[model samples]
Target chain A: MTNIKKLISKPLFLPIFCMILVMAVNIIFDAINGNFALNFFTISVRNGILYGRLIDVLNRGSEIAILAIGMTLVVSCSAGTDISVGSVMSLAASFCCMLLAGFGVSSTSSYNVPLFVGVIAGILLAGVCGAFNGALVAFLNVQPMVATLILFSAARAIGLLLCNNLIVYVRVDSFGVFGGHLGILPTPIIIAAVCILVATVLLKKTALGLYVQSVGINRKASRIAGVRSERIIFICYIICGLCAGIAGIIASSRITSADSNNIGLNFELDAILAVALGGNSLGGGKFRLAGSIIGAYTIQAITTTLYALGVSTEQAPVYKAIIVIIIVAIQAPPVKAFFARRQAKKAALKGGVA
Target chain B: MKSLKKINGNTLLLLITIALFVVMYIAGCVVYSTKGFTHLQTFLNILINNAGLLCVTCGMTCVMLTGGIDISVGSLIAMDCMFIAVGIEKWNMNPILLMVLVLVIGAVFGMVQGFCVGYLKIQPFIVTMAGMFFGRGMTAVICTEQVSVSSSELFVKIAQTKIELPFGAYTNNKGVLQVPYVRIPVVIALVVLIIVFLMLKYTKFGRSLYAVGGSEQSAVMMGLDVAKTKLKAYVLSSVLCSIGGICFCLNTMSGSVQQATGLEMDAISSAVIGGTLLTGGVGNVIGSFFGVLINGTISTLVKTNGKLLSSWSNIAVAALLCFFIILQSVFAKIKEKSK
Candidate 1:
């Protein structure tokens, strides 16, 4: 019973609770009126696959979800957040689009390469970029934030140089099909799920996660313990870069075009927030993949709810900022202290009354 | 040789920065002499155009010296400019009063963030990210569209007026070559730079800032109010950002929701380019002044070359930043080796 209560009172509980509560509100609103309608639990088999807003949220969330996975690893490895993910994702998106485009920027009739080839090329490039950033931090001993800021500023410039600063429209029937429906569900959700599964096994089921956590906790101690801490940190950044590349491919395919300025904008912040919402320490150490996954769902739910609430898409950030501030503030130490004091007072008053 | 060895890392960095400026300008003078790029007016133009950037870079330098960062300064500038525009255009508030009020508001904003970061022990990035959101969101809430100041006679008068330099002067009928000059914003920026230099150099508060940044435990042992020093640093940063916002207004003579987007990065980059270490305890304000100038000159060169993409400027800036970081790291390593 105490354990159940503790689970309910855990820092991770609020975000999950908030997600469900928001969905319930939207459901109730749907029932009352036709406007702002979002089906919370109308899952049914269609064409031998799942169909529902829950699935939609999962599908739409796969981009941030994948980024969050990479972010979790990087944070665990180095105790530093990478803000360059958004821009790196753009660079990947540009690569995918440009590879698919093949010829000059003029026509759709131009023969292009296969999807897997583009995917492989894009992820490799992104990984190289990530390794550059990692080399700066790991080998050169630069702080991760400042080191990543280089790529954050340069990634888009490189992306522009890739496509010659022109919007390349690739209309491969299979290119757009990358994000299309698989059976009845979204392809992104499946890819994201697979990625998460692999990540979980790599972290929770292997010794790498332990090394990462120890390094994050104390690099000197980890090094003393025979861990190649720099190599671990470097590999972690490379993983993040590859994951960002995957997210970019998913996004560009879904939209059918690569817009360098808009792809993965502010995603680093969202991924970091998701990690926080998962109750993982930003200072880095122990982390839970399950909690971070739930946090990703919560983010998707919030964004979907805002869209359904009729907020202009561009201005969604305003409402998101409010929600994020509230969520983060509530988790603040001072606020938690205040809550603990109130809870204690309530218990004391009840005891006196009894 | 002993004196050379005695030179500190920051001084070495400052020397490198000066050398870079000299090399860059000489190159600029060589390549683009056709457009009168070698003139004294062109040089002052860098200071005038980047006056706002100078202020914000100085602000970033201060916060970094205290081992903190305010990523929201860019957004805060947007909010500040918008508030001023609305105050002057819609409410008809006196320009001077609006400026003072905006400065106070900015200072209070910084104070709250500082208190959270210092007294409450919140991470500076998270606190300031929230601050960014609030500042940016508030601007949108104010009005999503552009707020022009050209309608206000006083604003137009202030913005349009240029304190002409003799550098732009041509030889008249008397064949006298006159020296060129600068505008009001440049003048204000120079004054602010001097004041900041003095504060960081002579004041106990300034030295305490460095002490706190170098090692908080030692600073505390040395009887410095670590929290207060940090708080003051933030307050000074935001106050300067507000003043920079005003200068941006004077430069563009308009305010919008999207004004100064990603400007905080430029300020930080300029400071880094100027030789201020991002890790804190190892920078000076004067270096940051030269840093902004370098960035401005790059942009100026790009403008002069009609064929190049403007995004190329960011590439150049990033390259310079990476170079300096590598240099600073090497310098630190060499110093450690000598020891």
Candidate 2:
């Protein structure tokens, strides 16, 4: 009983609860609306893969979910947020499009560019941009948000400059693999799973996670303990960049075009919110990858639910914000303290009765 | 040597910012001279055009001085503008009362965020980001379409009332003579900057802001009201943001949900470029004032160049921001080395 209670008390429990709560609400809403033709709760097999909103939540949530994984590390290490991930995604998107289309935005000419070239260049260019951010944050000691702000405004310009501000359509049929299926599931779902798997292995199977958490908790103390704090921070940013690069590829591929101005817009905020929802402290320290991954899907599910409920696109954000604020407030330290005190009082009363 | 120690590191950064502005302005002038942009009015126009930004930057500087940030200020500007527009257009409300109402709303918005940040110990970024979403979402909820204040006599008068200098007029290529004057909004922005400067330099609250930013625990040890100081800083930021919204509305004579998209970035970049350290404890409003001017100069230069991509301004501003951040980093390094 104590073990079960302790497990429920973990930070991961809240996000899991939220995920279930949203899913349950969607199910109830669907049942009431008599939308039996399209099942909202159960995943259906479509061809050789899965279909329905359950799969849609994970599939659509993949991009920001990948971003949340990278963000989890950066946030845990530096106790700060990166507002440039969206721009970096755009940068990567533009580069990938440019590589494939040979700087020609219109697909009037066949893209002779190889698929591998676009993917590698997209990932690398974003990594380099991330390096610039990391250099400022890790080496120069600038605040993460301020350092990232440099890229946030300019990354679009750089993206536009690369593609000459033209919207590029991906003409190659082969490029569809990124957005299409791979065996029994959507490719993005597989990519996101691989990303989580790799991150889990890297953090759990090695000492990197410990070092990062220590650095995040207290840099001076970590430094005294012989942790290479700067390198961990720099690598985390690079990882974030790589995640964005992958997200950019998926985003562009999903649309079959690259619009630097609009691609991955506002994704950084979503990722930050996801990490927060996962019960990870923005002040940095320990984290739960599984919880954050669930948080990402929960956010996506909320957006889906709002759209399904007939909320206009503009009005949807308001509902999402309201829900997010409530969740965040509940997670706030003061609220947590209140609950803890209340529980202790109940325990004392029970002890007196006994 | 003793006097040099008194000048502080931020002063060095301020000097560099001033020097960069001078160089950029001279370069702009050289380009302007050839492009028929040499009028004295062009110089004043920069100040006038960026009146809203100037006010926003002043508030941002104060907030940064307290080692906190308010990303929602941009959304607050949008909300304030929308509220005023709705009041003027739909309700037949008094414009003065509308202004007061928006300011109060802005203050309450800041107070809520401050309460979360300062007392509840929530992260400022998260709270403000939530606030940003709420403000922007609320703007759309009130009215998704643009609300034009151009029809309002007061709005038009405020927007169009320009304080003409005693300077001469310039004849355009069409041979039409044009008399140039700074708008009333510009005058208000400059006045606000001066007032903010005085408030920061002379007031007890101002000193308390610096003390708290310098070291929150130490400030508490010194018997300072740390939470209240942080809270007031946010309130001040929000109030100034409302004032900025008024200036912005005066410039546009309209309001839309997207009126000030990413304006928060502009304000923060301005504060940073102006020599205000993000870490807080050391900065001046005068520097933030100049940073606004620099942004205007870049935009004007882009406009005058005619063929340059609009993205160039963002690129240039980002580059300058990068350079200034490097300078700040070097200053930090020097400070650490000396210690």
| Candidate with maximal TM-score | 2
Stretches off by above 4 angstroms in model 1 are A1-5, A8-11, A28-38, A43-52, A103-109, A322-354, B89-93, B166-168, B171-181, B337-339
Q: lDDT tens string, model 1, A208-269? A: 88888888999999999899999999999999999999988888888877788788887877
- DockQ by candidate, in order: 0.45, 0.63
Docking class of 1: acceptable
TM-scores for every predicted model: 0.93, 0.95
Kindly report which residue pairs in candidate 1 clash with one another: B165-B180, B165-B181, B166-B179, B166-B180, B166-B181, B167-B179, B167-B180, B167-B181
Residue-level lDDT of model 2, residues A265-345, one tens digit each, is 768878988998898877799888887888888888888888888877766667766666777787778888999999899
Listed for each candidate, the true contacts retained, as a fraction, are 0.32, 0.62
Question: fnat, candidate 1?
Answer: 0.32
The lDDT values for all models are 0.83, 0.86
User: Where does candidate 2 stray beyond 4 Å?
Assistant: A1-7, A45-49, A344-354, B1-6, B168-177
Docking class of 2: medium
